[model samples]
Target: MYRWEQRGNLWCLNPSRPLGIVEMIGGGYLAARPQISYRFLLEELAAAGLVIRAWSYVPSLDHQGQAIAAWHSFQHEAKRSGPLNYQISRRPIRLGHSLGCKLHLLAPDYGRDCSALLAVSFNNFSINRSIPMWNILTARLGLRTEFNPSPLETLRLIKEKYVNPHNLVVRFNNDKFDQSYRLLETLQNRPNDRSQILVQQGSHLTPTSLGINDYGHNSWASDYLQRQQIGNFTKKLINWWEQNAC
Candidate 1:
């Protein structure tokens, strides 16, 4: 059994005796309700002796702003009480998926607070690539739209600012939108960086626990496959993290 609680926008999942913390940020729209969106993964981590704190937020054009807000919010919660304070005695492991990976990389503290980051399906697609119709509509209206830092600028910033480099960039074998290569390349260029990439056997949403939507709940076959995928991926992630922490 997992102890699940919601502290404002943060979702906390805890075990009776936690070995560590896995602070997470889910992908764009899915993040709006992280408790539901990441339930399976977070619970699995908790079962492996971890405390989880997942920050929930809506996607916005100002990704940088959202990044700062998420970082500060996690920091604030850690200072308050109970399992969240794990960051004080033992640094928490940061986990991010899809667009969530970019937000963690751009956090205000530059990843100094976390022990390391586990980026699953790192995605930094250009505005047009991410939202094809948006650019066309904006161009017709004589306006331009772009992420606050833009895709290229984000990589440039990572090369310059991001501090903690002990990262595991997980890329799927079939995720066409995955940008782990670019992200890992920038990170490895950093001085003393210890970043590695792991190619898994799934797609972009493999890290997510889908419900009725996205055709994930139509049949038992899908359920079995998803559970197997999530289980394998979770074991690989935690094993790598524990080995490195030692």
Candidate 2:
């Protein structure tokens, strides 16, 4: 069974099992917004027999302070409501999308307890200087680019602390976000015990772009919805937990 509860500004989804995962959504503007990814994740995880709890906090352009506070709150609430098996502590894992990934990568270190991280459609990359004025204007007006923080700082922090040299998985879409190659280069330097970089065909909003219909070779929409893929990912994450935890 699945239950949804409201906790202040956060939405908590409790599954029958104690073990659960948290996913943060991304809103381009400073105002908090909802994305289709959260719903898709919930349905997919539920089908896979895994408990999934999610929260969407107020979005902020102030990437320094409020963002950090929101993440801290997310961590606290997730821990309090999620499965408390002593075994799962050393196996902490996070899945974040877009700006959420950027914020998570900057999260303060919690010692060796923090184990694994998976980033999807992450948008932490330097701005291309060669873009035309019209394109820049359109990006600023259409996508609300001004609200986005410097990807350089986020990338630096991820390189220094976020990407655990022990376990990390990076999933990207080649069609969207041309800077993925550069992002991969930064992640490859880290000494992850097991690191995987998968390039699926799609765009930045692949989770919502392809929908749930066609499971094509150049698409991740199907993979995202696959129970077996979820199981496999969970198993890989659990293996990391077993090896790292005492």
Model 1 ranges with Cα > 4 A deviation: 82-89, 212-217
Per-residue CA lDDT of model 1 for 9-78, tens digit only, reads: 7989877777888889998899988877787788888888888889999998898999999888788777
lDDT (CA) for every model shown? 0.85, 0.51
Residue 103 displacement in candidate 1 (angstroms): 0.5
TM-scores for all candidates? 0.93, 0.65
* CA RMSD per model (angstroms): 2.2, 5.8
Among all candidates shown, the one with the greatest TM-score: 1
Give the clashing pairs for model 1.
Answer: none
